[model samples]
Target: MTRTRSTWSLDSMPDQSGRTVVITGANSGLGAVTARELSARGAAVVLACRDMSKGEQVTSSLPGAEVVRLDLASLESVREAADEIRGRHERIDLLVNNAGLMMTPRGVTQDGFELQVGTNHLGHFALTGLLLDRLLVTPGSRVVTVTSLAHRWGGGVLDFDNLQAERGYDSMGAYGRSKLTNLLFTHELQRRLAEARAQTIAVAAHPGLSRTSLARYLPLPVRPFIAAGTWVTGQSAAKGALPTLRAATDPTAVGSAFYGPSGPGETRGRPVAVGSSSGSRDPEAMRRLWEISEELTGVRPRFVPASAG
Candidate 1:
C-alpha cells in the first residue's frame, strides 16, 4: 500500500485520530500548515515554537491544540520544552523535527556549535533523544525529520573537522552541512531502532523549494533574486507541507524512507518517495554523525532492549 502515484495529497493520508503529535516551529510556514492539517484529523497537536505569541496565533482555530515554547538554538530551552510536553502527554505518537534555519550569517548556538547545525540538527537531536522514551513505548510511533535539497550543496558530504566552522564559514555551506547531518541522523536512528527491534521508526522528508520565511536570513544582495525565484517556482507553505505530512502519516512509509516533491529537480509538486544523495546513504558518515551528536548533546536515546534468544 505504498503511495506511488503522483497524485498523492493530504486527503489520502490515514486518519490520525487518537494520536498525539508534537511539531517544532509550528508558529508559521510549513510547520503551521502541518499542525493544522493533523489537528483537523483529530490529533492532539502540540505546537513547539520559539515565539509564544506567534504560536498562540495559530492555535485558536484548532481545538485541543497546545503551544510549548521551544527555542532550538538553546539546549536548555529544548530540554525544558521536552519536559513540559512529556509532563502533559503520556504518549507521543509523532515527533516532527520541523524547525530549522537556512543560510544565515555566521553564529553559534547557546551551546557554541555552529548556528545552522546547532539549531537544525543538534537541537532537534537532543529534543528527540529526551522525548524518545514516550515514543518508544507508543506503538507505531514515528520521528519524521524535515531535511532539504540543500543537503546536496557544497559537495554533499559533511566536513567532519569543520562541522562547527571554526576554520572558516560560508553561510550556504554550513546550512547544507547541517541538512546533510539531518539525513544522516535519520538513517542512523532508523538503524538503531531496527537493531533494538523497537516499534518507533525514523523517517526524513524535504519540502523542496517552498515559499517560507526561512530565506529571511539570506544576504541582502541575494534577497531579491531568491524572492523572485520563489515567487516563480515555489509552492505555498501548505503545499510545501505535503511532503512532511506524507512522510509523517503515510502508512506505507517505512524507516529511512524519504519524501519530497516529485516535480523536476524536486523543486515543487506532489510528494512521493524520493532518494537522497549517495553521500547521505553512506553508513560510516551516518555513524560518525550520530556519535558526534550524542557527545555534543549529552543525550542518548534509550530504546527497549532487543529480545534475548
Candidate 2:
C-alpha cells in the first residue's frame, strides 16, 4: 500500500458510516467541532462530558449524537461511563480522549491526585484500558489522544515523586506535565498494542493554540496577553480540531504517529504528522509511567509483553 503524504484538512475526512465514536468533553471547544463533523459524516457519536446539561445542549444540535456523563476527575465516574458504553455498544471504532483541564487553580481530584494530571492523563488511561477489549475486537479501531504544544515546555519530564504536585506547584508546569504524559501514554500504548498484535492502534493529536474555554483558567492579569497571543497565533475551534479529526480518520495515520498544525511552530494550519520532544519517546520513562498509571488507575491493559509476543 503506497501511502502518499499530502496536506490534510477537514474536507479530507472520509465518511464514517456505521462507526461509533466516543469523544470525551464533546460539549464544547474542539471536541464539539469534532463531534459535529463526525456526526454529519454519519457516525454514531457519543458525547462523554461531565455536565449532562451541556452535553444535552450539544447533542440536540447534532443528529445521531448522544450524551454520557463522564467526570474524568473521578475514577468512579469513568468506570460507570465505561460500563454504560460497553453495555450499549458491542464495538467502538474510535475513542477520542479529548477532555482535559488546562492551567487551573491549585486543587486535587476526588482520587487525591493533582487535578490537571488526574483529569488529563490518568482518567484517559483508565478509560482506554477498560475499553480495550471492545476496541481490539473491532477491526482497525483507533484511540486518538489529544495533547498540547505546552508539552514542549517543562523538559518533558514526568516528575513521578511530585506526580501530584503536592511538594510545589506551578499551574503551567502541572498542565505541561499532564500533556507530556499524554504523549508518553500514546507511545507506550502503541508499543503494547503492537506487541499484542491487536488490530487497534493508538495515536495522538494537538489542537495548537485554539480559541477555547480551556484557557479560561488563565490568571486575570495575563488574560489580555494571552488574548493578544491567541489573536496572532490561534485558530478557530473548528480549525483547531482538524489534527484530531485527521488522527482519528486519516487512512495513512499509523500507531504512535502525532498530528498537529503544519504552520511554523505548529501553532495553526492544516493537520500534518509532527514530531514531539525526544524525551516523549524515551522508552524507560514511557514504561515507568505506564506502570505507575496502572497502579494508580487499577485498570491494567490486557496485552502480551513484547518479549512474550
Candidate 3:
C-alpha cells in the first residue's frame, strides 16, 4: 500500500499544541536540536539523557521542556527513566529513540552486553516496549528511531550465538548490527502493532552522516576528516534533525516507512521518505531478535497479534 506523504516546513509541521515528545540523549547534537525544534513548535518535550545536570542546564533556557535521566547503556537506568516518564504522563504523543554511543572501546553494558548493540538497539527496544501502553493510549502516537547510513555496512548478520559480540567483537561490526536491528524492529513492530489493532505508528530515519558531538569517540585525527566531510557535505544538527522530525510529526508518516536525505547519495539534503534492504525485513531474523530482546531486557512480550495463528 502506498502511504500518504508529508512535507516538512518549520511552519507546515503539526502545531503539536498539546503533544508530548520524549527524546533520548536530548542534551546535545541532533537530540538537543530536535528537542529545541519540537519545543519551538509548541510541544511539551521530555529530554531523557544520561546526565540530568546537563539535561537540566540545557533546558533551563527553553520553555515547555523537562529533563530526566536515562543511560542507554544501563538497563536499570532505562527502567528508571521509563518509570519516570510513565508517572508524569498517561499518554505520549511521540517517542524518539535517538540516543547512541559510537565506536566506544570494547566493553559491556550495565546489562553485560556489547556496548554498541546493547545501548543503541537493546536499550531502546526495552524503552519502547515499556512505554508502548502510553503510546497506544495517546492519539496520533508515533515512534521515531534514528539510524545511520553506516547501518548498511554496520548491521552485520543476525547472530544469535554471539548476540552480544562477546566473542571477538569488532566495534563497527556491532554498531552496524545494532542499526540494522533498528530497521528490523521498526518494520516488525509496525506489523505487530497493526495486528493488535494499535493506532501508534513506527518509523525509522537516518541523519545522513552529519557532524555531531555524538561522534566524539572517534580518534582525534579522524575527527578532522569527519568534520571536513560533514562540513563539505554534512548539514547542521538542526538541519540533520529533519528526517526524525518528519517521521515523528508528519501526518503522512506510517509504520514501516524509512526516511533519509533527498541529497546526493542521500548523504545530505532535505529529509524524505525512503526504503530499506530485504535483509532488514527478514521475518525469521526479526522474530529471533524480538525473542532475544525480551530475554535480555524483560520488556514486553513481542507483540503477539490475533493472527498469530
Which candidate number maximizes lDDT?
1
TM-score-best of 1 and 3: 1
TM-score of 1: 0.97
TM-score, every prediction? 0.97, 0.95, 0.92
- Predicted structure 3, TM vs. truth: 0.92
The sequence of per-residue lDDT tens digits that candidate 3 reaches over residues 1-309 is 232343455665878789999999999899988898888888999999998888997798778688889999889998999999999998898999999988776888887888898999999999999888888877578889998877677334466677688788677777778888898888778888887877778999998878788677766768788778878988888778888888888787778889887777677777787766667888988887888888888886444322332
Show where candidate 3 strays beyond 4 Å.
1-7, 154-157, 301-309
Mind giving the per-residue lDDT tens digits that candidate 1 earns over 201-221?
999999988999999999999
Residues 1-309, model 2: lDDT tens digits: 122354776678899999999999999999999999999999999999998998999999888688999999999999999999999998899999999999999998889989999999999999999988878878889999999989878777677788889888899999999999999999999999998888889999998889999888998999889978997888999999999999999998899999888887788888888889888899998999999999999999896432333
- Native-referenced Cα lDDT, model 3: 0.83
Instruction: Say which prediction, candidate 2 or candidate 3, comes out ahead on lDDT.
Output: 2
Q: Candidate 1 regions off by >4 Å?
A: 1-5, 305-309
Clashing pairs in 3: 154-176, 155-176, 155-177, 230-234
Instruction: Tell me how far candidate 3 lies from the true structure as C-alpha RMSD in angstroms.
Output: 3.3
